[model samples]
Target: MAAPTPRALRRGEISFKLDERTAHSSLDLFKKDTSVIYRIVGIDPTKVPQNIERFTDWAVVLGDTAVSSGRHYWEVTVKRSHQFRIGVADLDISREGCIGVDNHSWVFAYAHRMWSAMLANKTTPISNIGHPERVGVLLDYDSKKLSLVDVSKLELIHSIPAEFQGPVVPAFALWDGELLTHSGLDVPKKLSGN
Candidate 1:
């Protein structure tokens, strides 16, 4: 059997950008806030005001826009990062801990060359796929389904079904390296089934 080719199924795209206010002190936002790089030196706290929305202990950032309804899709290109988490989470998710360890978030994580799908402290190991350069996220708000795709290979990495409490935003966590986000993308036919 061969992998399916990626094709556009619908025209649902979103204006996704990282919310700098929510970024951790150790992370620096660049590329018009579409990309973030982790800095060991960290930013000077004196320059950046303390905000409750900021992630205090984790290198995490949330999307500026929240999705409450309809279908949406976006992509994240992993650049020089071996450990990272890409997914969606409610706005109220704990800013102190890692994502996917709380009920408000669902993530596809890659760390130490391992892949897993996580939710509420539960980790489901995913095997048989190689490292992906770009990961695509598909959120069907009406259906409450979140999917993670290995865009480089055009493979479905994982999917989660949940009863979202309210609006959710794209969330990312990076311990090392950098990430670039691409938004306003049409939901792929292979994943959207339209």
Candidate 2:
């Protein structure tokens, strides 16, 4: 019998930061880098700004704002680089492991021309999608649905139902000199008194 041919895997779209508004948007996430290398330039009426970074390794950062309920959406720009992950995770998930390795987190990964959704250490392949210049993320906490979108063409890439145990925060990971710029952050209104 003849050997079977390898199944071709579709490569996800590579995106760029077309939205210049981020330069003035309010950033809700930052980390202790060699310096304050990351910054937010602008934000929308919702007060969510784009997260921008030139690309670094072994770095994980969480949004200062936490969302326990309601629907949320955000965009990430990866002007360059093919290895990075973006998603939401529980406030207490271990940063040591991969982003989507456990039930504590749900992340979308794109590399080597394939897009996959990971949760609870399970990975699902999403096909027929090319790397776009931008990717949008939608989260419906009440319904436990998380989706990834091709922002440049306004197309749906994939959606997964997630059962989260507690509050979740937007999470980002990058390494080996890869840069990712993300936009759209849901900022909660602060009360007058603590």
The prediction achieving the highest TM-score against the true structure is 1
Among these predictions, the greatest lDDT belongs to: 1
> Which lDDT tens digits does candidate 1 get at residues 1-194?
43221122232577777888889998999999999999988898667768778898889998887787888889998888999999888878887987899999999899989989899989999887667777788888888888887786656767888679987888999989999999988877777572
Please give each candidate's TM-score: 0.89, 0.63
Over 80-175, each residue of candidate 2 has an lDDT whose tens digit, in order, gives 546667788776666355578888889998777688998887889989777756787876777787788777655567888889787776666543
When summed lDDT is taken over every stretch of 10 residues in candidate 2, the lowest stretch is 5-14
- Which stretches in model 2 have alpha-carbon errors above 4 Å? 1-58, 176-194
Instruction: Provide the global lDDT of candidate 2 against the true structure.
Output: 0.56
In angstroms, the error of model 1 at 64 is: 0.4
